[model samples]
Structure formats: structure tokens, C-alpha cells
Target chain A: MAELELSGVSKVYGAFNALRDVSLQIADGEFAVFVGPSGCGKSTLLRLIAGLDPVSGGRIAIGGNDMTARQAGQRPVAMVFQNYALYPHMSVFENIAFPLQMERRTKDDIKREVSRAAEIVQLSTRLQDRPAKLSGGQRQRVAIARAIVRKPGIFLMDEPLSNLDAALRMEMRAELTQLHRRLGSTMVYVTHDQLEAMTMADRIVVLNGGRVEQVGAPMELYHNPANLFVAGFIGSPPMNFAAARVDAVEGHAARLTVEGLGSFAVSYDGKEVSAGDAVTIGIRPEAMLPGAGEAGHLSFRMTPETVERLGLHTIVHAPVGAKTFTALFNGDPRMARGSALDVSVPLAQLHLFDRNGAGRSIRDIQ
Target chain B: MTFRSGAADAPAFNQNLGAYLFLAPALLILFLSLLLPAAATIGMSFTDISFLRPTNFVGLDNYLRLLSDGRFQQAVFNTSYYTLGVTLPTMVLGLLAAVALNRRFPFRVAFRTIFYLPVLTSLIAAAVVWVYIYEPYSGPMNGLLVSLGLPPQPWLQSPNLAMTALIIMAVWRDFGTAMIIYLAGLQDIPEEIYEAARLDGAGKFAILRRITVPMLSSVTFYLMIILIVQSFQVFGAIYVMTGGGPLGSTETIVFQMYQTAFGYTEFGYAAAMSTVLFFVILLFSIVGTKIMRKGEA
Candidate 1:
């Protein structure tokens, strides 16, 4: 196991920057995931780390050695592709034995090692079956077994579960996490799913438009997002934002007027804003408590347009002035369309952002 | 080509009659074009049917004569040699070209088009061009050989070099077909497989040998059979360049059959030669298909 470091890593393709000045340090045995949207450059960053593609600028070092100029085969890494990419002609035994055979290991050693990996993935009985005969999950297990047999310093997975069905994706997610726990190997996984990153990563590097938005633990990013992008991306149903203007600034406290809503007193810790400054106020959907009129909480009256009762909880989608906000409640309120929702945004859970989309939680208002 | 439109009652007599009626036109074409000629050839092989003489049933005479015919034996040897020579090198070169063009390189499309140009050329047109290239004097091939300090020998005239020269020309003319087919096969392989293999520490040669060749076994087997079957019936090139010349050295089975039937008016003997060649090619194709099916499983 070894640490992986990227120093100012940049990838450019004919003036389009796929990744720009991305620098990160992943400690040995850490399960780091790069999560982002479709064009967010997460997969590109994984490719650069795997040595599948060269960086247009900067260096990559693994285990304290520079690997920027190394070819993919020269790197001490194993990759599991998105489609599982098992050699269709080879049986599970041969697929797992591939890397060891590439190293020209002896017959007995390859057999023993392949069997051990097959057992780890619970594919021992299907060792002689070709990839075409295996199910999607079993195929991924073969790919994982292939990577494990190599005993590489780092394991790279690029959207490896995206091809499986939803049920199998969940199953493989848990299996992959357990595999990482057992192996204790440095794994760099890339996926566009925020849920996968939230569940599997030791630390998640959220990317947006070829740049790092924020990198933190799952709950840390959920509770404290660094910017408007991270705040909007992390949580399910996402956080809602409403345009507001500052009316007064008084000793780390700002009185803001939310358009189409009402005025509120919010605490801040900056000289960055003054009267008449425009900002967006952010609140989580679950933070909106039903039946308002709580002191220090901003209250608003919205008309519910659609209500989704998901057995365990009720998701009330209501329109407040020009924007629609989602309010998640703990119990089904048997609410109907046009029902009155006295939604209250708790003062303790406010996320303040400047007009430039930068977070101004203003030094821990909570 | 299978349909179950009335398959619920397919076993009923009248229900099946409609299926047979619908299949009649295609079945007629198959009988006239394939089955009839094959049967006629088998029937004609037992006779001495020629324009100058009465048609007489000769039983096992022609078959017995073929076993001891030295000229026919030489033709068989030449055909086998040409088929093996052309098939192996053509496949190898075609695979290499397909692999090279599969990568992203400048002018890759232009190069691919250039390689496939010969496949679009007519067989006779390609043969005529090859004849010019293999011309004894002042030809491009001879000119280059002389420039490289190699001997400018008669390419299509010498008995020792005649068959080899024909096989080389055939390989050059037909490898474009192999390349195009191999390219289609190459496109079906996803790019992720290469990435996974590279990360598995497989070097360039190992990836090609272990992954690429194994993954393309079915395609290779398919191309092998096609090339073999096509090469076994080699006629046009020999007709244009060699004409079975320089002591019958380049005479293949089809060339001999053409000479027997058209050149000498011995239709019966030509039919026997064709029947023998057809069986040989069918055997090879069957064996090749079996290998391909087994590889897939």
C-alpha cells in the first residue's frame, strides 16, 4: 500500500481543459472517490492516475516516486472498468490468472493465487466458466478478482457499477466496501453518483467543470459544503436557494429581505457584505419543519403542488413565489395539492451564499 | 429466416402447406443453382461426355485414372501450396493493418481507404495490374529489385518461382478483403478491455498475443476459411499471368478444369476435377466453422 499524490495535474484537449490544476494527496490505504456530474472530469482524473492517459501538465507520484512519464503498464496499479471488461474468451480462472501470467509467474503460483482471489469474490465454483456465462454482478466480481490477484499498490475503478441493475448496484456497493475493508489497499474510484461516493469514500473529491469544488468526508460535506455547487450537489432532493437582499448589517448579524418571502435576522462573521447587497439563502429540504411560527426561524407560506408519500416519509413539493422548494417531513401529513404549508427554515441550519456563488456561512452561524 | 406465423398449428397438414408454398420460389432457385449443378457434375464424372464423341458411361474409369494422373497430382500440389501460402500471409498482414488503423492517427482514414481499394477492384482488373507489376523487364517490381541490388529474374516464367509469384500476387489482391473484415471485428472490441489489460501489467506484445488474438479467434477462423476457400479456387490470376505456363507449374485445380472443359472440350473430366475441389473446400470450411463455434463456447 502506498500514498497517491497529484501535483497540479491538468489535462487539456485542444483548448478544452478536461481537468485543471488538480492537486490531491490520498494517504496509503485510503478509499478516495472522485465524484461529479457527467462532464465534471472525474473519470478523466482517474484515467490520468491509472496512467491510461497522460497529463497535459504537472506530475503524478505514487508511493513517493514520480510516475508522470510512466506508461500504463509500468504503473503499479490495477483497474476495474465500468463494463467489467473481462476477456470474454477466457474462463474466470484464466481472467483472474491474467496479471500473474503477465508477470510470468509459475504455474503452481498462478493457480494458488487465482483460487484464493476466486474464493474472496465467492466465484470459486464458476472458475472455469467464460465471462459470457456469468451474470453482471459475477462478471464484476471476476474483474475485482482480476485486480486483486495482481496485488497492485493502488486499485482504480472507473464507474464500475454503472452497468449493473439498480438492485445489483446496491449489492455490489456493499460488497466493494467490504472488499476495500478487507484488502486495506489504496483504491481510487470514480463515479457520477453522489450516493455511491457518500457511502464508499474515505474522502470524496467533488469536481465541477474540471476543477475541484470541495474535498471532505461525506457528512462533513453534507453538513458544511464549501460553495453553492457542493451545497447543491451533496444531499438528496438537494438544498433549496432563494434570492435575498441585505437590509442592514449590525455586528456579525445581517437583516435580510428574501424576495417573495419575508425579512429575517441572520448572523454572519464578515465585512464582505453591506446594505443592499444581493445573496442567496440556502436550506436543506429536511430542515423545513412543518407548521411554522418557531422563534428565530424564518417562516413562509407556500402552496403544495405535489406530494409524494414514500411510505416512511412525505416529500411535499411546494411553490413559494417564483421558485419551487422541496420540504421533506418525517410523517405523511395526508397533504393535498394547494394545501397550506407553513414551512419554517430553522435558523440553526441556514446556508448563506454570496452573489458569486461562494458560501458565506460566515464563520459558523450554527 | 425462421418464422412462426402459423406455428401454433404448424404440425397440421394444410397449415404446413402454406409454409411450403411460400418457400417454393427460394427452394426452386436453390435447386437450379446449387443442387442441380452439383448432381450434374457427379453424374457427368462417370461418363466421357465430349462434343466430338458419343456420351458413354465409363463407371470408375475416370476416378481410377485421376488417382494415377501425374499432371492432376501436380495441379493438386500447386493448388494446396498456393492456398496455404496466400491464406496465412494475407491473414497476418490484414490483422496487422487492421490493428494499426484501429488506433487514432493522422491520415488513418486515408490509409484505410487506400488498403481497401484493391478489394473494390475487379478480379480481372487486379490480375492485369499484377501482371504488369510482375513484368520481366522495366516493371516497377523489377526496377525496385534492381535498385536494391537484387536479381531481376523472370517472375512469371520460371517453373521454380511461378507458383510462388502467383500466390504473392493473390495475397496482395485479396488481403484488402481480410483487412476490412478484421477491421469490422476489431470495432466490436470495447476500448475498456485494453485499458484493463494495460493496468494488469500486460505489455504491448503480451496484449496483442494474449488479448487481441484470443479475443478475435472467431473472426480469424472465419477469415481463414474464406481465404482458404477462395484461394483453393484460384484461376483468374494464373490465366492472366501464367496461363499454366513454364511446364504446368502454376496450374491449380480450377485452372486445369478451365483448360479441360473449355480449352480441350473435355467437359466430363473438368466436372470430376470440380467435384473433387468442391469436396476439399467444403471439408476445410466445415472444420474451420467447428473450430470457431468451439472457441465461442
Candidate 2:
């Protein structure tokens, strides 16, 4: 295994930049995931690490050796594409043995290594079956087995699970985690699905518009996003943002007046703000409590627009003033549309963003 | 509203019938143009019909005669040579041209249009042009040879060179269709497959042999069937350029059939020859399909 690093990487296609000044590092035996929305350059970053694409500018190193100018085959990395591009004409065994054959390995060694990879992927019984004859999951396994048989220092996966159905995707996720642990290779995985990144990655790198917005553990990103983009992108049902104005700025404590909820004092540490300066108050769906009336509670009346009962919990789509947002409840609320109730945004779970969308620390406020 | 309303469904059912009725004329025209003549040919092959008389009930007489006729035997040999000569080279040349054109280059569209110009031109016109180009003394081909200090020989007038001339013209005229088909097949291959192959340490030739050729079998099978069928039916070029001349060296089956029917007015025999040609084409198509299917399996 090798530690992979990218410094000041960028990719430009004609006049458009596909990836802008990006830098990241994956320690040996670490599973780092690049997660973002479509066209966010997550997959482009993965391709750069695999050497499938040349960087317009930057240096890439593997095991402390410069590999920026090397060809994909010359690099010590293997990749599993999203489509599982197994040769349709080759049998499962041949697909797994292709890299070894390309390297001019002996026939006996190719067979032994192919069989070992098949065993690891639990595809021993399908050695002779062609890719067309295999199931979707089996074809995916063949793709994985093809990558693993090479035993490269780094494993690169580009949204490999996005093609599978939900249950199969879950199964493959678990299998991939086990495979990573057993192989102990430095793996760089790319996916637009935040759930997959949260569940599998040792560190999650959130990207937006070809730039790395934040990099941290899953919960760290969830609870303490560095900016508005990461805060809105890293969670399910997304965070709710409401326009607010600074009502008062006293020492490190500031009194913010939300559009619908009147005024509430939020602890924030940043440059002193004018009374009419606009800011945004962020709160996750799970942090909003129903029917909590207290001073500085940030309470507002919401008319339940829709109720989605999801067995273990209920999701209430409610309209507060002019905007509609979702709030997750632990039990069935037995609530119907058009019902009115008061919801409170807990100050501890609340996040305050300046006009530039950068987070302001609450401790600095006091 | 009731779920089963009879009045509401009547117009919808009648519209369906009216649609089928409107399609009758075109369907009838197609059947009359193609299927009727095919059925007549099959029935006429069973009789012995001379040009000026009623066809007599001669069971398998034409078939028997064809077995011993030296000219018919020569025609079969000539047709086989022409088919194999044209099909294999055209396929290879077409594949090469397609691979070259698949890359980006200046004026690519213009080049593609120029290469495919022969396919769009009428075959009779192309053959007429080629006939002049193959003239023995002053043609460009002979002039080039004379300029190069090589002996200028009779091209279409020589039995040995007549068939070679026809094969070359056929390849030139027909390779565009095959090239277009191959281009489509090459485009259908996903870009990621090539990327994966490259990352697997495969060089260009290995990728072409192991990835491209295997992936292109289905297109190859299709092109081969069309080329073989067209090769056997090669009449316009042979008629316009060679006229089956130079001791009948270029007398293919279709050319012979045309001569028997029109030049000699031997209608029944000509129909019998047409029947034989049809069966030969069918045999090739069936055998080719079976081989391709077996390879796939």
C-alpha cells in the first residue's frame, strides 16, 4: 500500500475548468471518499489519482515518489468504473486475468491469481461464465475482482455502487468495506451519495464546483460544516436556512431577529455587525422540536403541509411564513395537513452564517 | 362515470379498423412487387421453357443440364473467385478506413463525404467511367505504367487481367457501405472500456486485437452477409466494363443469367439460373448466420 497525495491539481478543458486548484492526501490503508453533487469534480479527482486523466497542472505522488507524468498503466493503481466495464466477450475468469495477461505473467500464475480474486469476491462458481450470463451484482463482482487481482498499491472506485439496486448496493457496500479491511490498500472512492460516504469512508471530502469545501469525519461534517455549501450538502433532508437580521450586537453575544420568529439572541464570534446586516440561521431537520415555548427559543407557527409516515419516524413538511421546510419527528405525529403547531430551533443545534456563508463559532461570540 | 361504457368504445375500435384499411394499398403494392415475382420464379424453375414456346413439364432437366455444362461450371468458379476476392479485401480495407476516420482531423467531414461518394453514385455510371479508365493504350492506368518504364498490357482485353479489374472496381465501389457500418460499430463501444483497457497495461495493438475485434464480430457478420449477396449479384459492372469478354473470364452467374434471358431469349433456362442464384445466396446467408451464432454461443 502507498500513501497518495495531490498538490494544486487542476484540469481545464478548453476554456472551462473541470477541476480547480484541488489538493488532498490519502494515508496508507486509509479509505477516503470524495462526495458531492453531479458535476462537482469528485469523479474527476478520482480519475486524476488513477492516472486515467492527466492533470492540467499539479503534482501527484504515490509512496513519496512523483507519478504525475506517468501513464495509467505505469502507476501503481487500479480502478473500478461505474459501469463495471467487464469485457462482454470474456469469461469471468478471463476478465479477472486480463491485467495479469497484459503484464506478461506466466499462465499458471494468472490462473492462481484469478482464482484467488474470484474467491475473495465469492465468485468461484462463475469462472467460466461470460459477463452477459452474469447477474448485475455478479458483473459488479467481476469488475471488483478484476481490480483486486492486480494487487496494486491503490484502489480507485468511481461510483461503483450507483448502478446497483438499493438492496444490492447495501450488500456491496458491506462487501467492499470487508474487502478494504482485508486488503488494507489505500482506497479513494468517489460518489455523489452522501450516505455511502458517511457509512464507509474514514474521512469524507465534500466538494463543490471543483473545489474542496471541507474534509472531516462523517459526524464532524454533519455537526460542524465549515461553510454553507458543506452544511447544506452533507445531511439528509438537508438543513433549513432562514433569513435573519442582527437586532443587537453586544460584546460577543448578538441578538438576531428572524423574519417570522421575532428576535432571539445567538452566541456568535465574528466582526461586529450592523443592525440591518443580513445573515442566515441554519438548523437541521432533526434539531427542530415541536411545541417548545421559551425565551430565546426561536419559536414560529407552522401549518403542516404534508405528513410522511416512515414506520420508525414521521417527516412533517410544514410551512413557516413564506417558506416550507421539513422537520423529522421520532414517532408518528398523527398530524394531518393544515394543522397548526409551534416549532422551536434549539440554540445549541443552531448554526449562524455571515453574509459570505462562512460559519461563525458560538464560543468566540461569548 | 361507468367503467364499461359500450358507446364510448365504439369509435376507438372503428378507428383501429380504419387504420388497417388505410394501410392496404401500400402492403398490396409491396407483396405484388417482391413476393409475387419470387413465387413465380420458384414455380418456373420446375419447368423447361424455351424462348418461343410453351414451357414443358421437365422435372429437374435444367438442374441436370447445369451439372455438366462447362460454361455453367466456369461461371460458378468465376463467381466464387469474384466473391471471395472482393468481400475479404473490401472488409479489411473498410475496417482500416473506418479506424482512421474515427479520429479527429482537419476536414474530416469532407473526407468522409469523398470516401462515401462511390456508394451514392449509380453503379452503371461508375462502371462506364471505369471502362474508359481501363482502355488498353491511352488510359490513365496504362499511361502510368508506361511512364514508370513498365510494359503496358491489355487490361480488360486480357482474360487474366479482366477479372482482376472487375474485382478492384467492385471493391472501390462497395467499401463505403461497409466502412459506414464499421464506423457505427466502433462508435457504439463505450469510451470507458478503452480507458479500462489502457489502465490494464494494454498497448494499442493488444487493445485492438483483444477488445476491438471481439466486440466487432456482430458488425462483421452483418457486413459479410451483405457483401456476399451483392458479390454474387454483380452484373452491372461486368456488363458495362467487361461484357463477360476475354473468353468469358468475367462471366459471373448473374451476368450469364442476363445473357441467357436477353441475348439468347432462353427464358426458362434463364429462370432456372436465377433460381440457382437465389438458392446460392440463401445458402450463404444461412451458413454465415449459423457460424456467427455458434461463435457467439
Model 1: per-residue lDDT, tens digit, A1-366? 889999999999998999999999999999999999999999999999989999999999999999999999788889999999898878899999998998899999999999999999999999999899999999999999999998989999999999999999999999999999999999999999999999999999999999999898998989888778888999988999888899999988899988657888988776788899898888899998888757888888888889999978889888776788898888877678887867787787898888855554443434
lDDT at residue B260 of model 2 (Cα atoms): 86
Count clashing residue pairs per candidate.
Answer: 0, 1
- How high is the DockQ of candidate 2? 0.74
Return the lDDT, model 1, position B61.
Answer: 84
**lDDT of the structure predicted as candidate 1:** 0.89
User: What's model 1's lDDT at B145?
Assistant: 95
| Reference-based lDDT, each prediction | 0.89, 0.87
RMSD of candidate 2 to the truth, in angstroms, is 3.3
Q: Tell me the spans in candidate 1 whose CA falls farther than 4 Å from its real position.
A: A357-365, B1-36, B57-61, B137-143
Question: Candidate 2 chain B: worst 10 consecutive residues by lDDT?
Answer: B1-10
Poorest lDDT segment (10 consecutive residues) of candidate 2 chain A: A357-366
TM-score of chain A of each: 0.97, 0.95
Looking only at chain B, model 1 earns a TM-score of: 0.93
TM-score of each: 0.92, 0.93
Candidate 1 structure, TM-score to reference: 0.92
